[model samples]
Target: MTILDLPAAEAIRFAVPASRWDDAYAAGMSEAELLLYRSNLLGSDLTVTNFGGGNTSAKIMETDPLTGEAVPVLWVKGSGGDIGSMKLDGFATLYQDKLLGLEGHYAGDQDDDKMVGFLPHCTFNLNGRAASIDTPLHSLLPHRHIDHVHPDAIIALAASSNGEAVTREIWGDEIGWLPWKRPGFTLGIMIRDFARANPQAKGAMLAGHGIICWADTAKDCYEQTVRLISQAAEYLNTRLAGQPAFGGAAISPLTGRAAIASSLMPRLRGLMPNADNASRRKVGHFADDAETLEFVCSHDFSRLAALGTSCPDHFLRTKIAPLVLDPARLDDDTYLAQSLEDYRALYAAYYQRCKRANSPAMRDANPVVVLVPGVGRFTFAGDKATARIAGEFYLNAINVMRGAEAIGDYVALDEQEAFDIEYWLLEEAKLQRMPAPRPMVGRIALVTGGAGGIGAATAARMLREGACVMLADRDAAAVEEVRAGFARQFGKDVVRAVACDVTDEAQVSEAFAACSREFGGLDMLVANAGIASSAPIEQTTLELWNRNYDVLAQGYFLTAKHAWPLLKAMKEQGGTSVVFIGSKNAVAAAAGASAYASAKAAANHLARCLALEGAPEGIRVNVVNPDAVIRGSRIWDGDWRRERAASNGIDPGEELEAHYRNRSLLKRDVLPEDIAEAAYWLASDASAKSTGNMINVDAGNVQAFTR
Candidate 1:
């Protein structure tokens, strides 16, 4: 027995409330309330509809309160509204007759854009929301309630090469099949006409698009949707039931997964940004979910993934075929570099080939999905959320194609049809609403000592400026705590924490590697991990000296050593940056602090050397020297508070803060933010030409200023 052998009642989780059915309109509720309740219920099952993919609607008549005349309204899901979370506002109430009347004046050749322009005039106080493109299609249909969904199972048949034949075989005259059409005014009219021609049909599969089901009530339409989807699933299961699960020789791990991921991430990320400029940046997010890996490891992954999307709307979301990576070439940076370049070139060519005179100017021709043979999939976008969302859609597309391949041939619309949706005015409108890109919009950064006050604050600042951050610290629990807080502010995936002691070579390596694997690259390295120790030359012990130098000086060396390869690769595209957090003690020695001051002095010198070496490769290295910052500082927490107060001959709390605040030329606390701001300049293109320099952020530390 296979998935199809399951009992009908057990297959799908039909979540429509029983109370909703009992409270039906004529039975006791208004059409709007029933439709809304039903829409919410339908959206609750993601198997039927994924986020922002489908719509639900109903035709209702409500009496005009003032005129005492019945008004017909088509309550359809609006643009940018997820059916799963649909509310009354999510549905745009449009005058049904007004929408249907557009076709009389709208030329048969008019695309979705021209028809969409007329929607605002027809909407009935839609609260500033425009109806979805599917709104006109729903209103044109004679059914009282309609549901248009992208069901993986149904599309397996609908998006197949033999879709029309399969539809006729399964549903007979019960449903009509309309081959792919550019959806908008033209497609809507075509669907309505097909329904009229096949008056006995219950619903229709809009080939290479999705399925539409209709009935007099929302419940009937929903139930028909479930029943039709189930039939398709069962049909597909039977064809695929006897096939053995995919198996092949295990893929050899490329070098160390850590090191390869560490190096590969930056190389790929470096290429994502425009090579001609420092600012045209985009980020990559790596995901190796079970499904993604399973499919990519299968025998047919190359062919199936290279094929276009199973539906038309997916063109707008995933672009054309994903940029494919040869599994055997995963370890080669040179090979990966050329492949990504080819990927971009192909996309630009595809756009040029299909673009119309009126089409919007092409955005960057970057692949939304990058398939890495046995390694799995990496999704790219300007931000983490978009990448993850596109990943979900790509995963689903893979599954749908798998089913279609088993049943027949997995087929999508032609290039022109895909271009139609990809450049559709309605779809472009959504991308246009995105906020202006920030300086580090597509960059990724790694911050060490992130559990500490300055380190955590720097990470927060980087996240605000639009860089995905990896927070590495020796304190596992503290780093996790800081990570959770950053997650609340930035998205959960936007910030991650790794328990890595920078002083330990192995831990430092693993931590940086994880950053690459998770974020797909690294652009900025903020080496701020350090500890201070105070002792006279006579009292300084071997143990104390080693600990201070190991953390303060050796740690910076280790991080730079492990990070240089990635940064060098990044230089092939735009500029990359590195900053080592130094201390005022490095330049102005304090009594009984030979070990602390000397180590920081060495670290600062290392930054200067790195700047000299990395300059040819477009990597900038700098130092941010900060003086005493006591209040709310983890470095000054616990026993350090007593030590600091004793050294200053003052009380531990207010007095300690006042001592540092008064020491500054600005007569204010030399804050971690002040230092972070200095680092930000070095990280951004704003300091593109400034490298090998010490940026003093000590408020008024005249002693540490260049002399």
Candidate 2:
């Protein structure tokens, strides 16, 4: 098949509307926002093609007192955030001169220490965020826009058996392939120095990581990225298409069919929990496909585990590789046990071979893409976006290897070269500078329970923080009324309301899709729409259990599933964060609310698993478990309060006061605003380091009970 027939190649060319630029630029985006938008766009481009395995940047005019009024500023992508939803704050700004100075100060005595001092002079500090490690190189570039993307097709060529020769033939003059150096100022300086020597060169290829392309305009830069990858894809495709092929054969039996599948399925499901059984089956089948078996048998399946990333940034998604599975040789427990040892050995070898004399050791060695011998191939990522990226890289690598086999042999970058690029000092410095951005800005957020109380409060909170929000609820009139009121308060564009039933999957999907289409993409999700029905465990019938699950667990699952692609796309652009509005009952069980408690607990677990699975993709997932957000909620109405008071056998006012006073350590009722504040933090860059964590805004309710 031609390179165009390859999935990675096809995925890479997925067109983003040129109109997006017009929309973004016309939106009067701030300099910071523009930087963020461009960075994210580059990331999205790379992820769709390579799968969360690239970096991007932009250069803007900054006030330069030395130059009198205007000098170019370099705004490069940060380390911790996802490219898909990167905001203006996501790009670290550096003065051109300051970056150039970084190279001159790299003394042999203290590289890291010196690098830390250089960070503050840059414009990145203006926005109160850290700078990217690639800041120096990006600043050194003459171009206005730069994108360092690791297209799977290109990396396949870079890592091929004959990669060096193939690359030389295709890009001898226009592209420069540097011997691998650890990423940071050192690597940046290397590239900068090389580019200085070769004034005409447009970009460079880091032996193992990927390629860097720069140009005078965003379009030119993007075109260059596409051109180089397309050429590489075409070359590999043509080379492979001419080779002799083996017929399909059962090289190995599908052993440990149930056990291996079961163990792996949960992890996969965690990444895509709502994927139908059919989709899950497809992934499982592919893992044990004929090609996987053949590939496993052909290689030193044991030794192949040592390969480093297809590129460095891929670490954000793939996290090294898949666990190896060999059913015939070992039982379930034994197989699981051996996986860690295999991973460690592979990691050790890659580190030892790749580490520079004085640099820190490599962090992970297990291949993000795995071969399971008789089982098949598996790509491990926290989410589908990352999985898809790993899958693309693996497919391209396979094609490249096959082609190299035809051409005599594969020619991967030398071990030393790989190490150098991976540990490039300049690159590491950039990583230390920038912090992650808040999640909701530049995103469309939907709060399902938004018409009243918590949802309305969340909508206002997200809007104030720069998100376009859609408030959704089952009460159509209430939604409309709130929409008008919020529009009047926050301006017409900031908030909208949609009538929705959280229990209906079709409705939830449609609402989310509409929101994404209307406001670019959905980034922050608060699944707060729920009912709190109180009943003893004996009175909780099957219908009650099903009803609670429908709105609580199933609703979250469906909303997340439908929004996954968009969120993944946004994350690939930069980063996306999710906040699930859970209740204290999720962790602190109660006597009367069995169905509610069970569903909430399940939702909490789902959030944790999602956080683990989404991390590699740069999507942060967390839960805000709050207790008794009393003000403005339906439960606080006159009739409802009277009934609740009657049940508790007290005066209505006294019972209400007693409930709030008794439940919390602070002896105060939790306000919707308080919960909103917690949600805001979980959805922002402030919580980038935290995930799979539960933040309690319960006025110490849980703490009081526990104590």
Candidate 3:
């Protein structure tokens, strides 16, 4: 039945996920396909399991390719994959008998690493997929199909002090319970023995962990897992019906909480102490849903948060605990700095108290999660995706805490146990295996006139190197369409669009604010918006002169002015820059283009002034002068092209490009991408030490060359 079919009052509080299995669709599927179907269904709902936090498996008979005889193979979810999104190849296949045979060589807990090394030996047909730590947990069970998942409801019960009694109260003898132990061969054997002894048990709860259940059929195992979680959610909801979550609110949520979070995050990001000079800069995500607000504003927030998260998945993503901020002093920079300093010291002390001789070296001590009372939660990571996922994991942790406290006293994993898991060799190996960070990883940029050819090209190049970009253009619809294309090519997470006229003061301020709100701060600003006017000094009207200066000169001034505070805050983080798209006419006088040339000249001088003013704070400002960039240039689409062609005595249709090419020293045709390459270099670390300089992308125009 659907959740809506439940009694009205119960349905309102129900947090369970209904099964989405379609029997007709599963009718013709093979055993392995059915296993994948079960996994996708289970993982599709967060109430069923979290991202990358669960594994599913099936034991099936397959003909050995060499022997032409049937053999049982174990297929389990591989390491570092999300079950819901994985394809058939995501499963790691091994000889079930060989996987079980490894126990004969297992000495004890000390052989945990050694056992992981042995899994590859059991690979079926030399499948290259690596097995996860939970592979043994799935293989040792007697049933043919098994599901091991960490739903918030199930985790709440597992992490509660009275979990065993509560579990029995709900399910009687159908479910069993086991004491806490680290997941390894020993724990696998414990679960194996427990299942063997309890012949009538459908599933068992691992103390302070999650649940494991099994059945003879894939559908049966999937249904059993969902049923158990649904039951847990119902029981917890009943107990929590009238209970105040986290002992009621200690503070009211602030009005304009989002505005406050947007203001605070960039400063918060800046104040975090770096692990080293080469550490990846962190991006941020802000969450203010009712659940997050309730937990952050609760009377018991400090007490419970200090105890930390019980689930390893949550702990590893969010750190041992979040650093809570005082809502009253959120705007106080001194207070924020001191709080961050204290947190680093405390984290270092924790590592010192728990390190073993073989422990991986201490990591960056900055808190990944930050709690702002009355506002919401902020999570930071080396990229946008991880920052968003870390916030999701913390929200799950909050649900677990809410449920556990409703049932009984909430318990966290012991500190030393937490340390061992955090610094585990296997976990460290996984981190080390990650590909090196992209050149622009963790950088955020804003491009004005972003719907145009050069702006879009520059944005794409930065996104390719892993930077989040905000496209600000006067054409709202055009910029959105360009943004959609970028989102398609390079995930929706790293790109956002804001309709803005760069010449307007208020709009420019809000655009930079939107960048901070979306990705936590600005690392670079591309002052590229412009208007072209082809007129001699006598032919140029006051309106044309003002319009050209408004966009080309004042526009650069406004965007750079708005981006200053963020750039200063990120000074120590490094690579803060401003790249102005100036015209070649700014340096070399061009016939019949006095208004456009003079306005661009003003912008070029402004960059030099900003470069001088910003050098003390490590902010770099440079200019890229592009000449005769006719193809794909928005300015070239209008009368400017005809006016230039007429002045040069050439046809505007096709001869204009040839004439300009022939006049160039190198006879090269400059495209939008040519200008984008120069802008990208200035915006990146490659030009970190070069500023107040101009690069002319005019093929080989000696007249436009820097003096």
Candidate 4:
């Protein structure tokens, strides 16, 4: 048999001996817990499984705590649970007999949605954890352990035109193959009948979907899955011998990289009209990585680009086909706009042609992944992780298709079959499992002092929760690095960066201008840029006070003054917010730090006055007073760390953080995320009515209390 080589697989085998599975069976941990453990092993590897790509289950007996009666239950992955970090509660426990009984009644009508809706009611757990749509299929399977995954290697064969012939060539009768079908009531019935027909087979492959492997033990089933996929990988490696990546498809961008970043990314964000002059859903973020670049730049791009996705799960994630940008028109905004319009029209037509009664409205017509010839494949999503999932999946898919093309023609389910799965209620239900977006979603935020500490953390946090962010800092390289990294992860529209000396009025104006140009306007302004450690009065020079006050005092003033118009305009949608990153020093002066203390104190008063002026314009101003947030903070970077360490009688590197950790009444180490969470809540609607206040985030600093 082939060997398991995935990193997650290796880690599991190392941590749990081969006998661990047997030990678990004897230990009396519920089957749900066992499945949860194994599911995490598989879900940890993106190469084998993505965010919600695969599921696991086992049938077992659980004794009722009250009656002491043994009962049969089917434990399946819940609808919205991530396999990697899933717990016992993440699995839905259903009465085995009731779950299996549903198969007999399903006539396959609008019942698809009804069946999913009724799953929670059937769940044995009273907490309302919903079962996945594939619960019935898992219940009907006779095997003790079952796993279903959309592995990249398996997808190459399953999606290929010659998959059946190739699958048989590789495994012969070891694995049975099924025609492309949306997973539901009828599909569950097929799995049952298929298993009965081939009692000796190891598992089954779901064409245009994924693979399933089953065995008496979780370890045995997992091993079999690895062996089967490894065999496929070996076959693929042989076929890829002579072909070069990006061989036939590569062409230069019509313009240069600088031009693309400066002009192309923004133009793509514009409102492009359809043939009827109606604009569709605006695209969100753009994502690209090294692998995505290779595929889009390959010479064989056209032939591969025309093919559909390797599996149907991606029809929900990436859609059927990514809109390929015209290579020659990369520099022309008008041509790009016209092309996007055409792309929307084509998608609308595709939906109309195949949509059945009760079909969900066609997903926004804009493409998720856009391939620019010279630039790379750009994945647009509502968030970074989704964008990465689509980009990563497609990049892997290209290799799978290359393998298939080497052996035979790469094929996918027909348009009708793909449409059926895309519109299926079971597939649509998965989205409901996602955590509700934060209140700041669809809003724009500009954060100053974003290079490190609270500023960087807040920018990332806001972007993750669904707000577009613009990061401003005088550290040019740091700002760009954060900007570029976040842009790649969250899409270009999701994050922007400007190297602005916040104390400079011109740079502040330019920062706001850039913010408006990218995201239209801003709803939240976090004036967090400041430096520390001014000399005491006796030793202080004119320069020390000016430098300290310029950043802590004037920086806050300039950012607020320049951002007011945009903040006021935010009233059309909702009230805007200004969160100043003040310090505990504002309320309590530290001796030998007159300039620093006085500067922050001035900034603190500025916030209160700004609140009075901004209240009339619906611009709520607030401040977060925090002390000593060390990690990822430049504030503790240089001479100050060594001096503080010496004063504490500890090593500079080892105990610098510990020295301050004890100063708080709570004795907790304040980190950047703590400050960020405070800023996030203030910027969100949670503090909509309560503004013009200062929140002390110092973990109980009574020295500055009651100020």
Candidate 5:
């Protein structure tokens, strides 16, 4: 493990000026405001440290000394709020005394009755969802200021089996270590009891979780967290000195750092396209640091490469990691597709293990970082603060993990344990508080035959609209590769790729089920997967007819049947829509395409029937028929096109041109983006009142037939 060592002088100080402390205190600090402040601190610190997975809190007091009245309000970080931009009201507030009472009821013996009554007064912001289950722990602590951080140094030691023993050796009596427990009232009780028993202890470590420290001042809490963890990190680094040699695929000596940095300028500019040149210049300056360069170069050949996340909470802003470059892999599209599949599998495995260990599942498993062989790291966040923080923390954690591996054995928290923390009750509660009805925020959606031109385009469109989309196809890997490209271009939450043959009911059903399990629920269905085989009536075969109907007709029926109830529920709650990717072939009587035309016509009728049946339940169903979308698609390639052209006794290029420029009123080829846009419109609120409608997206090709 490469260990990042922090200077000793910076590790032991924990004092903030009284004036600064007073300013924070006087900031009309409501429970919400306090929560946001603590969140920002944790987020900032985590970005600086590596993979800092932890929480923070503040105690707000409502007291009337003369009237002999006092009320303690606990404002704690909600599960999903990124610390860097955590706003007021982002923190969930609960009555202090109510939470403290839960400390008396241990996790093993606590019943639902006891749990419900334990904190009746505890309510999160109506929009924020549930409070962190750690509310109880924060309430029970004596200090008004509290901070919990997962310092890379401490994690380096704590993730191992001998973490407790190592912690004891490093801090001795000054620190305490608590065995990992499911975080909530149970963990709170354990910490409260430990605090009471060890009054002189400065901080406590939750093995496999993180570290916690409290003080009368925010600076004290912050400094203590940084210093203590920094000390442990330095110690580990010293122990590992001169061990594992860092030689791998050596970076070329001729590749100047400046040139590498300059090469990345365009990408960075693209990453922050909205920002002006000056702002981009500032961002570039930050990205060009030596530490950033070293960290980027470190992953050239390491087996377990650090993609660049400091902690899980970073997902709210920076996402998981930077885009990694591998010199051996050059085709960006191909690389993106393959890498996405690898990422999804890893996430699925992680989620399964976590579930087995009795932990709740996370929403999506998209990789935050992309590994590009030679190119430097490309950090992504929703905003600048998150990106900067994530960048800093990624550098530090990479160094520390590398150093630690060099010393003794380095172990990470088990997948299940990590899952438990990731989906802890506190986190779940926080999710519940969002005021906006993102009812389907973590739901799954499946688009069949999604690797085909229109299908692929629709899948990408749905994903960008915030659906955890699964693109199912017979060519599973290829489809997933396309889905992955979309995920990379957008964000991980937008898409997922799964392999399946839509013509096979078993495969289609299985794909839908997998997507549901991965994302928690099934919300929207896009039965856009279909096949087209054109032939003269005399030449059409039973096999071709069966294959076409199986996908274009039976496939849609099966998908709707399985997904109806979920869609009904979503619609009842408002904001749910389904779109069928139909084809202009259904309406136009094209020669030598009897099988293809019949299948699409049947699908169109099925969609209309579905719309009628689903509308009563509030589920809107619509269809879009598009023609001539040949760019970036296999439909225009190989023997399939050759056969079509030969039937017309025309050159392939000219045949395609006639189909596009001559047949359509627009005198232009229809693009996938055009079809995608229609799909989006049908799925959004803009079409809320327009159910049972068929949108034609053919660029004038249909006009000739209609006329």
Candidate 6:
């Protein structure tokens, strides 16, 4: 049989992480540069460390700005920075001597919360990057260069019931072990004392935490860290041979898991509670890979998940525990709703049981991670990046659990300790210090004709305000180029592209489905795809009339008709919106454009009718009309510009825009950006109460004004 057909336990294997150091690359580098190179290499492997879950430090001599004398400085990864993607500026620099001197101010373990306040006072070189709480853990360690990372294999050993005994069995005197302690001044001191007493030891494992290794040179330190993790992984793999992980699988995975996830995501998102428009809404991500499916379908899944995660990093991201659901009953709405309520109630009780008088108020109690027995996992957070990262963190937890159970019983952290870390006052301050979220932070939008000028501009405005957008256009290459540019400017997680001809009903349906799959649901729809034809009534053939209707009229109908269900599902998220990009010709008649004007008029009326039907459900529909957006419009690059200019007795090449501008009552030029601004307002909550209305962006053309 093929490897894919084997059970997960039988297919499990662990490969040691190899060193990626290059002597030629590190030959002429300074101490700080070597530290960065080492950090990037170690963080490159997930088996070495998860994202933003570790810190590395180097004590180096640098010329003091104040005294012009060389002083020893400690450079470590700053708060909220991921080592995998960090640059030199990402490190927080502090005076090494000043950090060590703080040992005298330590009034004991109770002062851990206050000790963080003094880190800024020890800042070296006026670096503004904030030091993380783990600074003490690295600074107090008696070594010139140190690496502390949360590798899954090492954590599996650290989190097992017999962690100390197993650690001694594997490394003997080379590695030492310490009992569980929250990272702080005391833990650092404990590690320092342990290292001094056992100078022969290279590193120590902090029980239920992670491993640390040290050396005199940067290369030695990096190689030692890699060696210890590789050794632990090899030991685990040997012990796990012929042993079923998590007591073997209880249920086999079902087929078509993606389809199931897509079907359930919208309903799940709708059931979540949102306080108001000011509060950030949740965006969802789904994963159904083989590894995830194996754990979710295991026999011990329910029990182990209840125990929660051991590492502080894992616990903070995945929450105290995940909400588990039965795969068989997934189709039952009552069951799903009740399970969510049960999970929230238990979380509240946990908070009330463990809360101190000064503990931060309970945050949202909804589960960030959810497990389906026969499927995989679903994670939700305030944005796409966070949601996706949270999923990655949980996968690390899964690997830790699998390794721990393969050798011995996996031990979770104490409830009191978990609560203390989760509700730490220092962490609360960091949260409060974060910048306020933008207005469209968790919104998802889909724009038709996104390769064209107006659609692309509207999409950019939405993205700048923090919305995820899906660009659907018939010109696949042009749309992809736009998606790439936006992805670079915003982020890869927030923008996507799909080729679509709006006139085709099947393609339109699939486009909306793709949006739902990429993001949980749609919050806004911009029906902006269009075509133009300018011919006298007698000269307008049946083919021309049909082509105009197929795009401007039928295309809008198909897009809106498909967007209705997803928008209705997301109504609780500050209400949903549909902004139709109409034209001045829709309301004001022009001599030679009978077919184009009439089709646009049909689209305008469609918005009003939709508004009447959707008002009861909190869905708003509106229109934006433009008179002469000739600068970047795709329609103006062809026969339409010449036709209009010929009818108006002007040069089509140079005088077209000016002729249309002077004819307007306001005598001003109308541009694509002007139309985009109107569209943004109509879709945002600023215009929430006003729907079934038309906003004319025609430079004050009296004939086109709404009456």
Which candidate comes out best when scored by lDDT?
3
Instruction: Residues 175-237, candidate 6: write the lDDT tens digits.
Output: 999999998888888899999999999899999999988999999999989898999999988
- For model 4, how does the per-residue alpha-carbon lDDT over 120-169 read when each residue is reduced to its tens digit? 75676464677877776688787889888877778878887888888999
Q: What's the count of clashing pairs in each model shown?
A: 1, 59, 0, 11, 42, 0
**TM values, all candidates:** 0.88, 0.51, 0.96, 0.68, 0.47, 0.95
lDDT of each: 0.77, 0.63, 0.89, 0.73, 0.59, 0.88
List, residue by residue over 512-571, the lDDT tens digit for candidate 2: 655643343456788788776667778778898898898889988887776666566544
Candidate 1 residue-wise lDDT, 1-707, digit = tens: 00112111111111222222344343655788777777776676766766677788898886655577888888888887887777787788878888878876776664457778788888775457777777777988988999888877777777788778888988999988987776677777788888989889998898877888899986788778777877777776666664522232124223344455455666777767553234655566676666666566555666677777868656566887898876557668788778878988887888899998989987776677887755667777777777777887887787677667765788866888787778876677877886677767778899999988789889888999888899999999999999998889877968899999988999988887888777777789999988876666898899999988999999999999888876787786667899999999988878878888999999999999999999998999999998886654777876557766787789988888888888888898877787888888888888889899898887878788788
Q: What local lDDT score does residue 573 receive in model 3, on the 0 to 100 scale?
A: 84
Higher-scoring candidate on TM-score, 2 or 6: 6
- Taking every candidate in turn, the Cα RMSD to the unseen true structure, in Å, is 5.2, 12.7, 4.2, 10.0, 16.5, 2.7
lDDT of 6: 0.88
lDDT of candidate 4 at residue 680, scale 0 to 100: 89
Better of 3 and 5 by TM-score: 3
Off by over 4 Å in 1: 1-45, 60-70, 85-89, 142-144, 168-174, 196-201, 215-227, 245-260, 273-278
Tell me model 4's lDDT, rounded to 2 decimals. Answer: 0.73
Task: State the number of backbone clashes in model 1.
Answer: 1
| Weakest 10 consecutive residues of candidate 3 by summed lDDT | 1-10
Evaluate candidate 6 by giving its C-alpha RMSD to the native, one decimal. 2.7
* Candidate 1 lDDT trough over 10 residues, lowest sum: 1-10
Give the RMSD in angstroms, all C-alphas superposed, for model 3.
Answer: 4.2
